[model samples]
Target: MKKQIRFILTSVSILLSMFCGLENSYSLEENVKIEECSDLNCVRSHIDEINKGIVLLLAKRMQYVVQAGEIKLKNNIVTAYDKKRAELVVNNAEEFAKEKGLPSGFTKEIFQVIVDKSRDFEQIKMDKKSNLDKIKTKK
Candidate 1:
């Protein structure tokens, strides 16, 4: 039947769209350019320090985002605010990179992954809190 064929085609299209949506969230580029340096040792040391700084900064930002999520839950703030805060984290990371004479695009790509992970963590926290609240209400 034509209706059955159409239904199957529509289902396939929806599934493919979902898959593409997930893939688009991640960075697809494999290579990122770093500034060329004549002193290999200096470059290596600087990169090490930069990496440490980025990790520390990201951890601090995630902590704040988690705290914000808790406050949002308490106050019933909209989810869009939480997503905006995550975007701010990526923006800050890119600014930090530019300040340090590093490539902004590369740093932004790195922070995109960080943002995605933070969002996942925030979602898990939100889910657990909602479940706990439901249990309390039921008791």
Candidate 2:
């Protein structure tokens, strides 16, 4: 069972490293550097880097959400919040967190916040596009 879990994690890590498309972003092990932590200051620095990385990832994700909003508008989808998809995302994050020995509920909460904000950003993008269309039509 341990081997299986390790294998799954390895596969996912490889895939993410290859396809995540974030330049200069380190993997989990590289980002943490537990062995190199000689003092509290070193640990704090690592934490800061990890936090910055999280923000960068969130920004990148929002960029895609913005594009998705535009595509939704073009295709006449008319809805920013897809309940099913949001649930799936949170569930998946929870499961992954469990596999990584993290608190599943905490992971679920974090993902829920992300999804809510993403929905809001998506809605805002759609509204701006709609307003632009209205202005264009009036001209």
Candidate 3:
């Protein structure tokens, strides 16, 4: 019974250590910072503007993706092309964020959101095209 108890405790300790290490790996301590702005309202406004710019860039990227989808459909190309493009966008965004002194995790999250949105958009476009084809066939 004593030996069994020690073995259980040692197993628990190893599990706990592994869990802590995994948690630390996912922690964003180095990626995000919160600091008090001297001019709170002004700083907020500036940040908002910067966010808007990023949004605009995201929009442009989505537009390009949509166009690519259209071209792919016309040329009998596969979604693999789009997947490659999306991966490049994510990589570039990560590099850009690091160069701009932005948090890499935050930047990556934003890009992932963009990628999700683009995928949704592409799906909708494909669905519409399929529907249109059905309508034409019916006609």
Q: Per-prediction TM-score, please?
A: 0.53, 0.75, 0.59
The deviation in Å at residue 73 for candidate 3 is: 1.0
Can you write out model 3's per-residue Cα lDDT over 50-131, one digit (the tens) per residue? 4465557756977887787777777765452356767887889789756644544655655665676677777678667766
Return whichever of 1 and 2 wins on lDDT: 2
Ranking by lDDT: 2, 1, 3
| Worst 10-residue lDDT window, candidate 1 | 24-33
Point to the candidate with the largest lDDT: 2
List of clashing residue pairs for candidate 3: none
Instruction: Kindly list the per-residue Cα lDDT of model 1 for residues 1-139, writing each as its tens digit.
Output: 3453344344333332333234332211223333445675855564455546545775697787788778878887635235576688779977965654444476576566656766777767777887899899999
RMSD for each of the candidates? 15.1, 11.0, 15.1
Candidate 2 residue pairs that clash = none
Best by TM-score: 2
RMSD of 2: 11.0
Stretches of candidate 3 off by over 4 Å are 1-38, 78-81
* Residue 31 in model 3: lDDT: 40
Worst-scoring 10-residue span by lDDT in model 3: 19-28
